[model samples]
Target: MDHAVVIGASMSGLLAAAALHRLFGRVTVLDRDTLPTVDAHRRGVAQSRHAHGLLAKGREVIDELLPGLSAELVAQGAIRGDLQRDARHIHGGHRLARGDSGLSGLLASRPLLEGQIRRRVSALPGVRVLADRIATGLLAQDGRVTGVRPADGEPIPADLVVDAGGRGSRTPFWLGELGYEPPREERVVIDVRYGTREFRRRPGDLDGDLVVIIAPTPEHPRGGVALALEDERWIVTMAGYGEGPGLALTEFADYAATLPVLDLHHLIRNAEPVGEPRSYRNPAGVRRCYERLSRFPEGLLVIGDAVCAFNPLYGQGMTVAALEAKVLLEAELRPQAFFRRIAKIVDAPWDITVGGDLKMPGVEGDPTPRMRMVNAYLERFHAAAAHDPELVLRFLRVTNLYDPPPSLMSPAALLKVLRGGAPRAVPVPA
Candidate 1:
């Protein structure tokens, strides 16, 4: 293809642009937000102020797409530490054992991460980042997308158009207008609400750990997470589902204190607030089943949140987007092949997020027998992680998307769960 256009200059769009830059002669990325020059938040990103975890698998893909990117992040003040060893985690009402799992990633503000990638992608040969423009509609003719129509400008023509407009995308409507069936949607309403605030970090904050996580358990549905950010700062996010507590500036710390773990709340209570608290609601887990569509435009492919918006609590959005971008880099620009690849790319994240949401009372869908077994085993696995560092590493591997979820169900893992080894506050010595 000579030219490919990516709509929405979010992480997924940028990554897609980078992938296409090598194959196509020219690539263009458009976004509505006038992307800020500095490492600052933009109006387009709803969860920019929240805690974002670049899981192990995501870190690898980023480094693959932009070599030396991780180093740049760290040099620019991103904290680097073992995913488990330097972090505190509580799950299934027990603390996960701390130990080195050979997985590490940069902990930085969302803007910093996206800003760096945007700058790099913009500088790439034959790549253009156009801000202050929104894709008003798809340009289609003869069953193939011809380009995209911008809100205020003449249509930009292209051989292919990819939608990364996230969950708010209007691609389905555009498809309907083109006499094509939009992908059917699978939605599980979570009613998840979270508030985030940045805090000035000191050397001794959270006893110098990079992250303190009080994950939500069945008993205490409210949860909290704190991550060490660039420039001696921290971003703490507290979340709840259904009839949760108030998510406001005045109530942030109070909500944190109710978490299953105290370290997150304790740190935020003492740390100086650097910014006003901001809250965002992830109303549901939505997956547009594009793979199920019998017919789709040849020149159009949907990626990122435009295809599936995972539950934010899992931190799978960016990672899944990056993986899909990688797939786009290699796959032929055909609808069937593209949808198949992205479907496989999305399956893990969808299962993890959608399955978790369905477990909560009042949410939609009945858990499959296999899902019940998996969740039951995982609960035991979390309890075992308190005692067995190996089991903890295995759990982290699956959660980080480094390993398949089936790894957690291996006979060996099941035996480890049956054994239910010893317990310790910290599995590895500092």
Candidate 2:
């Protein structure tokens, strides 16, 4: 390919450019929002200021795609902690036993992670990043995408155009304009709201735990996570499935007090608040079934949130995008073949996210018999994980995308879960 143009300077887009820089003569990445020069949040990404976790699989993939990236992040103040040992997971109202699972996650804000990756990808040869450029429409000829028309600039031609425009991507509309059918969409309404705040980090705040997650259970619909970020700060987010907590400081802290575990509440209660809280709401988990399309234009492709935008609560979006970018590295970049390949990548995480959401009431979905069985087993697994470090490792491995979900159903894992302890109440400070 002589010149390839990618829409939206997102994580997926940047990674796609990394994969294409070696194949194409020049790659141009365009975004509507002016890209940030510092580790500051941009206007485009709604969750930019929120806490972000780069799962173990995501970290490994990005590291391989851009050499020495993770190390640079840590050196720049990102926290690297063993997934099992340094993090406390309170799920099914059980604090999972901690052990060194050999899986490490890089904890940083979204701005830091995206900014670092953006810098590295921009430095690659023949890769140019252009900000404040809006892709108004697609330019197609002879059933193939020839280029993109920018709102404020002249049309730029290309051999291929990749849309990483995220959840609000206009590819469907563009396809419809070209006399083609749009892909069918599958959506699960979650109505999840997030109230996030930053706080001054103090030594021994979490008692050496670098991250704490209070996952909502069937009995409790509220969830919260506090992660240690760079600059000696902690970004804490309190979320709810339907009616989330208020973003005001007092209300946010009050909601945290209602969590099954008091650790998150105590830490934020004692620490000095860094700034006013910010809020975000995700109405649903949407997946555009582009792979199901009978016909697609050549010289065009879609990746990342443009294809599937999951519930941000699971923290699977970035990881899955990385995996999709890895697929592009090996595929021929044909729209049909590329979409088909990424569908396989989307299946697992989609199931995981949707399955977990269905466990809560009011989330609209008819669970399969298998989903019900797996969810029931997971409750038991979480309860058991509190007593068995091996069980914790098994579950974390699956969630991290290092192992298949079936691994959790193995006879050995089943036996371990069967002999585990019951869920107990987490003690709160008086």
Candidate 3:
């Protein structure tokens, strides 16, 4: 390919640029937001201000894409920890297993991680990060993309156009205008609101565990997550169905108090507040059924949130986007082959995010036999997790995209749940 245009210079766009640079002579990444010179969040990505998690699987993929990136992140203050061993979690009034499952996760602010990776990707031979630029629409001829139209400038010709504009992408509309059938979308209304704040990480927090997650069960629909980041700071995020208490520190305390786990409540009470609390709402989880489309435009591919957006609560968005980039890296970027591979890449995380949301009681989706069985099993599975570190490990493996969802339903796992019981309470932070 002579030229490739990637919309949205965020994580996914940057990754796509890195992948395309090898095949195309010139790769340009376009974004509307003024690119930050430092590690700071941008308006285009409002959720970056909230708590974000990088699963082990995603980190591994990044490492493969950019060698020594993980070491660089850790050197810059990313907290590296074994998923189950160093992190504490409680779900459905039960504690998860706490042993080394060989799964490792790196926790850092989204901006920091994105900044470091962007720098490396931009350093490549023919990659360009163009900021303050907008992709108004797609330029196509006879069902094949020919270029990109700018918001206030001339159109740029290209051999390929990758839509990485995320959930707010206009590709569907563009496809409609181009006389191609837009991919049908499947949605599950989660209506989740997130509140986040940064605090000073004192000597001992959450009894010295690097992270703590208080998951929201059907009975208790309020929950939050807190993690120790670099520079003696901690980031905490809480979720609710709708109408949060408020983002004020006091309001955050009130919301945390509602969760069955008191670790967050206690932390909210004692920590030195760094800034004003912020909250964002996610009305639903969306998956654009690109795989079902019989015909798609040539020289046009949609990746990342533009194709499927998962609930941020699972911290799977960036990870899924990275996986999609991996697919684009290996494939020839044909419509059917690419979409099918992308579907396979997202199926596990999408199912996990949507499946977990459906357990919230009000979210609507077809409760297929598999869904019902998984939900029913988790009730017992959570109780059993306290004693069986193996069960907790399995959950983490699936959640992190390290293993497929089917691994959780293995006969051995079911047997473990059958033999498990009530969990002990977590100790207060010393």
Candidate 4:
């Protein structure tokens, strides 16, 4: 019977296990941290407490993997609402024109989402979770991975190995020890920092709308705020660019009071803090050119942040991981060729994320002329989205990874931008 071993019991790891469980007879998930009995924050995921949203495509992927998950989340007190109708979006100090695309999503804590997915994955036939086990290195033969060795002792043999370990993955070192060159890496760095605080939603909080206040970076030092998760709770995060310090507890309320968008600020003013603000800083935007590696080990693959970790502000990591899991399911039938297929599938999100990150003034990377043109168009598209609801929907569709970036440059979309006038103000419902 075929057995698969996945390192790191993260959302990406759990999803990898789910994908492998469908193809292999048995799947073992290994994690260095002790798995929590409840949906609570752990050391493994430092960003768990921060605000996270499931884009329309991500919601669809999760629903496909675990049927009724969206509804289940709602049953568990998560909010479900139309993306445009209920969402308050701001770009470049202007509120985006609301659209009626009916693209709705689930709002839940990262811990909650991870817990649900873990529960569902654990219930899969022949899948088991092994916590507090650290993967030290790969056991290989003839230059191909066959299993993994735990830090304590003994090797866990498997027909396939997947590294879903997050940004700090040791896959590159393990591959090098096996006499294979590491994949080419492309990195873009933006000095971004964030401080997040959760609040208990008061009556009439949000005014029945999901709050999303965003400001562009490079030019604008301060970032944005998003109110998500439980219906009665809000996770508000304040971010800053360059070397700017993130918001402090004493300053968070004051900072929120100044956003160009009033809805988020209003909600913050009326809401009561549920927890202390947590701060985090991210400087690396990485893309591993694993697909370009000519001698990648057979029966071994890397997914999620192990492969490419984007800026958290983009909120693309979880969605891209889910999309990658879906791609893995489709390619599992041909394990030998699966990595190549998965590599191609990963390109879409990588482009969207890395491309966007490169836009920051101080970020360093190679942006081909084509990429520059693409970014140029997107800038106008974003500006246009502030006025045109139809254009905004299309932009959301592409930004959410439901469609390719090229889709934003389609003839129809281009014409919309060419003919679309400057951004128009949208009046808030009183």
TM-score of each: 0.95, 0.96, 0.95, 0.92
Q: lDDT by residue for model 1 over 1-430, one digit each (tens)? A: 7999999999999998888888889999999999898889899997898899888898899888888899998899988889888998888778988888899867988999999999999999999999999889988888889999999989999998989999899999999999989888988888988888888989877777888877787677777788888888888888888754454545676877788877877887767788677878888889999989998988998899999999888888999999999987788879888988899878987898777777776676798876776667677778887988888898888888878888876878777876783342221111
Query: Which candidate leads the pack in TM-score?
Result: 2
Candidate 3 clashes between residue pairs 3 or more apart in a chain or in different chains? none
Q: List per-candidate RMSD values in Å.
A: 4.1, 4.3, 4.5, 4.5
From the highest TM-score down, the ranking of the candidates is: 2, 3, 1, 4
**For residues 1-430, could you state the per-residue lDDT of candidate 4 as single tens digits?**
4899999898889887877787889999999998888988989898887777677888898788777888877888788878887777776556789868678877888888888888888889999998899999999998668899999878999888889999999999998888888888888777777778888876666666776757654455566767666757888887765643335555776766555555556666656778777888788878887777777777788888998888787787888788887877776534336657766657877676676667666677777766667666665676778878988788778767777777777878777765663444322111
lDDT of each: 0.84, 0.89, 0.85, 0.77
Candidate 1 Cα misplacement greater than 4 A, ranges: 243-250, 421-430
lDDT of 3 at 147: 96
Error of 3 at 360 (Å): 1.5
Mind sharing the TM-score for model 1?
0.95
- Candidate 1: worst-modelled 10 consecutive residues by lDDT: 421-430
Candidate 2 least-lDDT 10 residues? 421-430
lDDT (Cα, 0-100) at 262 in candidate 3: 86
Q: Which pairs clash in the backbone of model 4?
A: none
What lDDT tens digits, residue by residue, belong to model 3 across residues 1-430?
7999999997999888878888899999999999899998889999998888888888998887788999999999888898888998898788776898788789898889999988998898888898999998889887789999999788999999999999999999998889888889989998898889999999767778888888888888777899888788889999876544478888888888988888888986988989777879999999999999998899999999999988888888888888888887798788788999989988988877777788786677667767767777777778888788988988888888878977866888866776664443322111
Instruction: Give the runs in model 3 whose Cα sits over 4 Å from its true position.
Output: 421-430
